[model samples]
Target: MHYVNAKGILSNKNGMNLYRGCTHGCIYCDSRSNVYNMDHAFEDIEIKANATELLKKALKNKKEKVMIGTGSMTDPYIPLEKKIQSVRESLELINKYGHGFTCITKSNLVLRDLDLLKEINEKAKVVIQMTLTTYDEDLCKILEPNVCTTKERVKVLKILNKHDIPTVVWLCPILPFINDTEENINGILDYCIDSNVKGIICFGMGMTLREGNREYFYSKLDKQFPGLKEKYIKTYGNNYGIASPNQKELMKIFYKRTNENKIMNNPDEIFEYLHEFPSKDKTKQTTLF
Candidate 1:
């Protein structure tokens, strides 16, 4: 791990990445693509040394209160977070400024900030988003090796639900010929339903492959799924979106299950929910006045 002073923290859209690069060895990580242009190795995490301070400054200058998001390019709750505590400090700042908070992560370590999240939700809003790629515990280990497994993530969702904090799940990157199956989709959907997640974001039933990530993905496939690299090359040579042959079938199951469960399934709609700051506190104050 390494540290670097960041010029700025929040994006124009109110998102920030406290770290650059990730240790989670997910083979299909798009952040490794040449399009992102990282100067260091992917595992050598670059800490944004002044992220919390910059975030505080940004929040203070905002014209109106809005949700602040993180963990887009890298999970904020990565193992290294246990030491840096940047995410925790950022949450404290968001709560201090009365801004809503949301983040996308696969780590159960998010539970460490339950107190801050609850406090923020009571004041404004706090939504926890988790990514669930495969349902089978063994397959989940293979896909998202460095982070918490699917079952453990589901437990986090359930616990958040019990606390009345809404949650969303990213059901994506379903590797073609590996995890793109009816059983896999149904199993993950069952977990979402049981946990009462507010929504599920799925960009279809496939993962993307590009110059940098594609090469790394193929290398891992050769080692883990032997012969799969050749199949991918033969089928998707130079293509960006490596969609699954079962995309239509799996999507049918996804839409059917999420719709029946009353969970938001549309990507645009789910994003709106994540970005929208609730007015419950404001309404209560107005009512009292």
Candidate 2:
């Protein structure tokens, strides 16, 4: 782990990444793509040493309260987070300023901040978004190694649901012939149903592979699935989005299940929901009546 001063903390959309690079080791991690231009090794972990300070200033001076988001570039709950507590500190700032908060992560460590999440949710809105790729435990390990398995994540989701904290699940990157099966989809969807998730975001039954990630994914595929790399080459070539052969069928299953469970299934709808902020206490009251 290392620290570097960042010019700014929040992005144009009010999103911030307290850390750069991730160690979760998701072979299909899109963040590993060269487009992001990460300077350090993927697992080296770069800390924005002043993220909390910058965030405090940004929130303190904001003309209006809005949803503060993070974990789009890297999971904010990585192991280093336990040692550094940057995410927690930033959350404190967001809560202190009466701003809504949301984060996308794949770790159960978010449980540690459940009280803060609940506080924000009560005063404003707090959404906990978790990515669920494979329902099978063993497959989850290979895909998202070094993080808590899907089962543990489900428990966290259920806990949030019990606290009335809205939860969204991202069921994505369904690799062809690996985890695109109906059983896998149903298994994960079942967890969503059981946990009473408010929404689910899935682009499609596919995964994107580019210069950096494609090589790593293919290399891992070669090591674990033998002959899978050749199959991917023959199937996808240099294309980016590799759709599952069962995309149509799997999508049908997804729509049917989500509709029956009353969970938001459209990616656009979920994204819009996450970005929208509640106007609670938006304008300062003149009197303390």
Candidate 3:
């Protein structure tokens, strides 16, 4: 891990990434793509040394209370977070300033800040977003080796639900020829249903492969699943969108299950929910003149 003096912390939309790069060795990570242009190795996490300070300042100066999000390009609950507590500090700032909060993470480390999340939800709102790519515990280990397994993440979701905190699930980057199957999709959906997640965001039944990420993914495929790399090359051949051959059928199951469970499935609608901050205004009392 390394540190840098950052000029700013929050994005135009109030999104924050306390660190750059990641240690979670997910083979299909799109952040590894050269298009992002990271100067350091992906595992050498770049810590924003001034993230909490900048966030404190940003929240203090902001004119309106709005939802502040994180974990877009990098998961805020990465292993380094256990030591730095940057995300936890930022959450304190958000709660202190009466602003809503949300984040997307695959790790169960987020449960550490459950107290602050509840406080923020009571004052404004706190929506926890988790990514569940694979349901099978053994397969989850192979896919996201550095982080906690999917079952542990599900436990986090259930805990948040028990606290009456809303949760959303990002069911994405479904690698073709690997986990694109009815059993896998159904298993994950069952978890979402049981967790009582407010929504499930799934763009499609397949994942994306690009310049830098493609090479890395192919390399991992060769290492973990020998000869599978050749199959991807023969099928995709440098295509950016590697849609699953079973995309149509898998999507059919996705919509059917989410709709049946009353879980929001539309990406746009779910995003709107994530961005919306609750109004804290109380009804004014009337006095007779």
Candidate 4:
């Protein structure tokens, strides 16, 4: 890991990535695409030395309390987070400023900030977004090797639910001819139902492959599942969005299960929920007036 001074922290939409690059070795990581243009190796995490301070300043100057999001290009709970604690510090700042908070992560390390997340939710809103790719534990290990398995992530969701903290699951990147199956979708949906997740965001039943990430993904595919790389090349060729042949079938299951469980399935609606800041404080102030 290397440190670099960041000029700013939060994005125009109140999102921030305290680090660049990731160590989570997920083969289908789109962040590895050359479109992002990272100068360093994907594993060499670039730490934002001033992220917390910048976040503090940003939160202090905000005219209205809005949701602060992180872990988009990089997961905030990456192992490096345990050492640097930038995400933790940012959470403290968000809570201190009474702003809503949300993040997307694949690691169970998010459990470390349970108290702060609970506090933020009680004050405003705090939503935990986790990505679940493969439901099979062994397959999950293969797919998201560096992070916690599906069962562990489900546990985190359940714990958050127990605390009355809303959670959303990103059910995506279902690699074609690999994990795109009824059993896999059903298993993951079962977990979301059991966890009482507020929503499940699934753009489609497949993952994207591009310049940098495509080569890396094929390499891993060759190493882990021999001959599968050739199959992908033959099927997808130069396509960027590698939709699953079973996309329609799998999506049918996804929509059916999520709708049956009353989990929000519309991407737009879920995003609105994530970005919406609670008006409880405003209501309280109005009452006082």
What tens-digit string does per-residue lDDT give for candidate 2 at 56-169?
999999887788888888999999999999999988888899988889999999999998998989988899999998999999998888999999999999999999999999
Clashing pairs in 4: none
TM-score of 4: 0.96
User: What are the runs in model 2 whose C-alpha is more than 4 Å off?
Assistant: 281-289
Encode model 3's per-residue lDDT on 149-172: one tens digit a residue.
999999999999999999999999
Candidates' lDDT values, in order? 0.89, 0.90, 0.91, 0.90
Q: How many Å off is the CA of 101 in candidate 4?
A: 0.4
Write one digit per residue (lDDT tens) for candidate 4, span 1-289. 9999999998788888999999999989999999999999999999999887888899999888888888889999999999999999998999999998899999999999999999999998889999998988998888789988999999999999999999999998899999999999999999999999999999999889989999999988988899999899899998988899999998999998888889999998888888888685444221000
Candidate 4 Cα deviation (angstroms), residue 138: 1.2
> Candidate 1 on 1-289: residue-level lDDT in tens?
8999999998778888999899889988999999998999999999988888898899899877888888889999999999999999999999999998999999999999999999999898889999998889998888789998999999999999999999999998899999999999999999999999999999888889888998899888998999999999899898998899998989988988888889999998888778877675534211000
Question: Candidate 1 — which residues are off by over 4 angstroms?
Answer: 280-289
